[model samples]
Target: MSEAKMNPMHELSDNVAVPFEQARAMPPSVYTSTEFLEQELDKVFRQDWLCAGRSSSLPNPGDYTTMEIAGEPIMVLRDRDGSLRAQSNVCRHRMSTLLEGRGTVKSIVCPYHAWTYNLDGSLRGAPAMMHNTAFCKSEISLPTIRCEDWKGWIMVALNPDATPVGEGLAEVDALIGHYGMENYVESFCETHRWNTNWKVLAENFMESYHLPVCHAGTIGGTVDLEKMTCPEGRPAFNYHWILKDNTMPLTLAHPNNTHLVGDDRNKTYLLSIYPALLITLTPGYFWYLSLQPDGPDHVNILFGGGLAPEFRDDPEAATHFKALKTLLDEVNDEDRGCTEKVYRGLCAKSAEPGLLSHLERPNFDFARYLNAKIQGEG
Candidate 1:
C-alpha cells in the first residue's frame, strides 16, 4: 500500500555498518521497496530454512497445516506412518491450491477438480485419467519440499539443499537445552497480518530498547535494558539474553519453571534464527514468531507459544493461558504501533537511516546475516 512512495533506487546496504555503535539501522528504503521485497523472496526466504510451527500441532497421523513461503503454497502433513512431509500444495491436474488452512483430512482432495493425494503426497485418485494411458497415475505426485523436525518445531525450505535447521540450532539447543523446550506444550497459536515490513518486527523482537517506551504497560517493567547481552551466533541464527526484573506480573513464580543450573535461570534468551524464525525462551515458558513477507508493506506472522508441561496440566492452566494470550496481545499491540509508524515514516521523502543503539547489536548482526544472503554468500 505504501509502495507508491518508496524510492526504487534505494540501497539500504549503504546505510548499515559493523561495530554496532558505528553502524546504522537498515534504511527505510529496505522496508518499503517493492523491488527489494521481490528479491528477498528468492534470495533469503525461499533459500533459507524457515520454520512452520510445532510438530505437536500435527501429532495425529492425518493432521496437517497449509503454509505459504515466499509465495509458494505448502502442505505440511503427517502421514499414517508418523513421518512429517512438506509438499507443494498445488495440484498437478490444474495447478490449483489444494488446501486453504488446517485440519485432519483423510486425503488431499482438490475442491476444484477432484484430484486426490494420499497423506504422503502420492496421487491417490484421478477423476478421469484412467483411459489416458499416456498419463501414468503412479508417476503423478505433488512436488516434495525439504522439511525437518528440529526439537519439535517443523522447519521447511523451498531450496532442495538449504542448511538443515537442526544443524543451524545445535548450539542453541546445547545452550538452552536445560529449559526443556521439548516439554513446552503450546497453549496458544495464531497467525495475524501486520501492515509493515517483516524486518520491522524482526528488529523489534531483537532489541530491549523499545520495552520501556513501547511496552510500558506490559513487559516493560519486568526487564532491564542494561542487562541485555547480544552475542554472535552461528551462521543461521543470532541471540541476546536479557535479565529479568522482579516487577512484572508475568514473572511470578510457577511450579514448572525448572532445570536451569545457574544465571540462565534468571535470564530469557531472544534468539532469531537468521532469515525468519524468532524464538523467545524463559525457564517456565517459550514463544516464537515465524515471519513471512506477503508484500513490500505486508507481513504474515505465524506465532506459537506455550508453558512448560508441568504448568499446562494445572487446574488453572486454562485461565492462565487466557491471561498469557491477553498479555501477548497487549505487547503485540505496542509493537504494531512502532512498526507501522516506522513503515509510514519511511515512505516520506525526508526519512533517513539512523545510528543503532548498543541494545540493537543483535539487530545489526541480523542485518549482516541479511547482507550475506543478499550477496549470495548464504
Candidate 2:
C-alpha cells in the first residue's frame, strides 16, 4: 500500500517526524476525525494550562469569569484577599453550574438550589442541610484547580500536575517583556462560535503566508511578505514576526513610548501558545483568541483585545481604538471565511494536504507539538 493509503494517525505521526524543510501540511483527518478530536480533548486541552483572559478584567475582588475546558466547567475569580482562584463552577449540592459568562458576585449562589459558596471556594452556607447528620459544611467546598497569572493573562490548568505557566513561557516573556504586556488593559472580551475545527483557526493565526491574499481587503495591503520571518518554535509556543512600518499608527509604538528601541518599535509578533491561545502583539496594542473545540466541525472562541497604557491617555485614543476595533472585526470576518472553507475542503473524500511554505514553520512546529502531546511524550 502507498503512504496515502496508510492509517491516517500514523501518517500524521510520520509527517511531523520529518524536518521543517521537508514538512507538509497535516492530513485532513487531523481536523476531520472525531476519534482524533476526542484524544486531543484528553491529551491536549485537559493537560495544558489554558489562557482564560486578562487578569486586569478581574480587578475587583468579586469579579469572575467562567469557561469550560474539556467538558469540565471552571471559574477564575479574584478572592476577597486580592488573590486569584480557580475552582469548579458546578455546585456541590446537585452538580448544577454556579456561574455563566462574566460578572461580579458577592458570593456564588446556585440558581437551582441557592447553595451559596464564598469567593474562595469555601461553602459559606447551605440551606436546610443542618438537619442532615452526614453533612459537613467544612468539607463541602468546591474543588480547587491549579491557577496562575502569567504576565497579564489568566491561566488555569485542569490537570493538577501540569507545568507552571511561567516556566514554559519564559522565553516568550523575555522577547516581549520590555513592552510591559502585563500592564496592558483589556477593552473587551467576547465569546463566539465558529463552524471550523479549533486547530484550523489556530494554524491560520500561526502563519502570515496567507495575509496578503486572505486579508487583502482589510489589513493585508500593508504587509510586505518578504519582511516576515518564521523561526523555529519553542516547546511551549510558536511565534513569527513581521517587521515593517504599520499603516495604523496605533499598532506602532506611541510617540511617548521610550522603552522599545529600533525594530522593536515596529515589530508585530504573532504568538501561538500551545493547545489554543493565539495572540497578535504590536507595540501599541494587542489582541488574542482563546480557542476551544466543540467537535470536529466547530470551535468556541474567546476573542479580545486592548491598548497599551501609553496609547490609552492619548488625546485621540477613543477614536483610534474605535477605528482599530472596526478593522479587527473585518480581519476576523475574513479569517472566518478562509478557515471555514478549509474545513469544508478537509471533509471531502479527495482532501489532501499540500507542501508547506517557509512562512509556515510555526504550523509545522504546532503539528509536532500536537503529535508529541497525543503520543504521551509530554
Candidate 3:
C-alpha cells in the first residue's frame, strides 16, 4: 500500500467520510462564543484527566502544586504516606481560595479566616471556631479530588467518576513507550499569557503543513514536506511524523534516545493528547506545551522540556539551551501572530469556515473531539 493509503491516522474516509477535498472548516463561533466555552469547561476540562506537571516536581512529601481548572481551585500534593492526593483549594470555613501557587506545605492555611488543612485534606485546625456548639471543626475537610501519576506526567480530574488517568491513557502509554519519557527531566517551567485561543496553538503544534511558510527560517528548512506522514489518530490522541536529516541543530539525535529505527530514527513525532496536551519528540530532545484556556481571546501556556539525560550533561548544554530558547521565541512570535490574527478574523462579520487541507487531519480530529464533548458522545 502507498504511504498515504496505509495511514490509519487520517481515517478521513471512515470517520468523517467527507473527502478532504470537500471538507469545510468548523464555524468560527466554535472559537469565539462564550456559551461554547462554558460547555467546554463543564464537559471537557471538568471531566477529562487534565495534565498538571511532572511527577518529579512533587517528589517530596508535602510538595504540592496548584492551578485553577474550569474555575475550580485545585491542589495536587504528596501526602505524609508518600502517595499523591488532589483536593479543592477552597477553604471550608468561608469558601475563600486556600492556595495561590505551588510549594511544600505542612498544612494548607486559609489567609482569610485561619482555617487550616493537612496535606491529606484533613482539617488540621479551625482557629477561633470553638465558640458555638453547632460548629464542628474536626469533621470539616477540604473536598478531595482524583489524581494519578502516568509515567512522569501528573494529572487530576474534577469528576469523581472520571476514568483513571493511567487506564484512560493506556493506549498512548504503550504507543510511544520507546521514548522512555519517565526519565525525561523538566529543565524549565514557564507560564505565558498569549492573546490567542488555546485551540489555535493546539492545532499549530500538531501539523507540519504550515512549516514551509510559518517557520521558513528555522524548522521549515529541515523538514521535507513530501517525507511527512500522518499516522492514524487513536481514540485518546493523534500523531504525525516527518523525516528530517540527521544534521538538525536544535534536536541532534542523542545516544540514549536512539531506539527508534528505520525512518523512525530520522522521524520526529508531533503528538496532541486531545484537548490541551501538545508534545514534540525527536530522536535527541523533546518539549511540550500544556494549554489552559483563559477565555475566548486568551490562553495560558505551561511550556517546558529539555534534552535527554545524556545531552543534559553536555558541556555546551547551557549554550545549546540558550540558542534553543532564542530560536523558539522567534517561532512562537510567528505562531502567536498567526493565531491572534486568525482569532481577530474569526470575529469578522464576513468570516466563514474555510477548506481543510489534507495536511490538517489533526484539526479535523480536534473538531471531532469537540463535537463529541459538545454532543455528550465522548
lDDT of each: 0.81, 0.91, 0.77
Clash numbers, per candidate: 0, 0, 4
Per-residue CA lDDT of model 3 for 261-362, tens digit only, reads: 666666678889877888887666677888889998899888777766656777887876777667777877788777788888888989877787778887
TM-score of 3: 0.90
- TM-score of each candidate structure, all chains considered together: 0.94, 0.98, 0.90
Query: Which candidate number would show the highest lDDT if scored against the true structure?
Result: 2
Runs in model 2 lying further than 4 Å from the true structure: 1-6
Q: Which candidate leads the pack in TM-score?
A: 2
Clashing pairs in 1: none
Query: Which residue runs does candidate 1 get wrong by more than 4 Å?
Result: 1-10, 248-253, 256-258
lDDT of 1 by residue, 319-349 (tens): 7678778888888889899989888888898
Error of 3 at 177 (Å): 0.5
lDDT at 281, model 1: 81
